[model samples]
Target: MLDFHMVYTCGYWSGSPECGLDDAQQQKLNLVCRNLNLKPGQTVLDILSFAKFAAENAGAKVVGITISKEQAALVRDLCKGLNAEIRFEDYRDTLGEFDHIVSLGMFEHVGPKNYRIYMERISGLLTNGGLFLLHIIGAT
Candidate 1:
């Protein structure tokens, strides 16, 4: 049930055949993952995960957490192929560490008041020299 909804709403059910997302969206996502040059066995944490697209394309284990439990379950079910784990918690509440961090479309939620805190948490979670990717939308 949860998986179905995620596959549909998280831009997966569009039936585009390229991971179910638009070409531009897929290209942007693939570009970022490829630029990272992730190792095959790396553990990649996807902050505020949507359909697990980025994580899946990276060929790494995925740890996805979302503020909404439903969202987490959806991602968990959607990422069945990849080594994926889903948790329900505010990003601030998550404490586990990872090899790499890829956060997409989540910076807007941090706001100016919480940006530093968010960065610090992300820093804390990453192992030394581990890469971090922060993808956000710029204001008009």
Candidate 2:
């Protein structure tokens, strides 16, 4: 259903539900990058490969981690020539400090048991005074 940028999660419509899927997905990406205050040459860690918007729109260097090899390959191809790199690996195995971090639709997978550890890892990877945004869809 999400052929537009394969967002996979709900859009950041911001009350613009009249917009089409592609527009909504693009808005979601832009919203995340803007909230993170990403800037040119700055390092950004995206839990999913939503780097296109941050890299192209905000000119930030984005490093994304995904467990699926196929998804990584596709995102890598899509982000070619941009300051975006997609890695096929577990998030816990990731290293390096980033000026900002954005995690979308992945917190739920972290599970309650690993919540503390997950947050700690993300904290360690972020530089002091860095920004972190965690977006999730709640279904009770």
Candidate 3:
């Protein structure tokens, strides 16, 4: 059940019509890592995202925050022996600056009332020249 990089969220299916779920997930992960330019020993905030992948593949030290206990546990297990920490809490309560931040399909829960605050916090948590990758689904 944990195969295919343990992808539990949306995948990037924009490439290769013949690609399967694993390929799509790989593509999405690769795309994000490339965009963030993940590097060795860099600090990253994943907003409860693909931290294990980044920590393992890029040698990044990642902190992933989520409101879900299940997700936190799963990520903690997946990131075992890596430079990754999964926190179960509100993102607003998370502290510290990061070299890069990435969130995939999480902005939908930021409720309008807290949208501005959330964005502000994200900005505040970013170090100078840090990159942020926000991947969301468009409702049409």
Highest TM-score scorer = 2
Clashing pairs in 3: none
| Cα lDDT for residue 6, candidate 2 | 68
lDDT of 3 at 59: 92
**TM-score for each model:** 0.78, 0.91, 0.91
- The C-alpha local distance difference test score for the whole of candidate 2 amounts to 0.84
TM-score of 1: 0.78
Q: Could you give candidate 1's per-residue lDDT for residues 1-140 as a string of tens digits? A: 12322422123233445553454455555555676777666877777543376556656777777887777776676777767788887778887777888887778778899988999999999987888888776787
Q: Please give the CA lDDT of all the candidate structures.
A: 0.68, 0.84, 0.85
Q: What's the best-to-worst order under lDDT?
A: 3, 2, 1
Instruction: Name the lDDT value of residue 97 in candidate 1.
Output: 73
Cα RMSD for candidate 2?
1.6
Clashes of 1: 0
- The candidate scoring highest on lDDT is 3
Stretches > 4 Å off in candidate 2: 1-3, 14-17
* TM-score result, candidate 2: 0.91
Candidate 2: residue 135 lDDT (0-100): 89
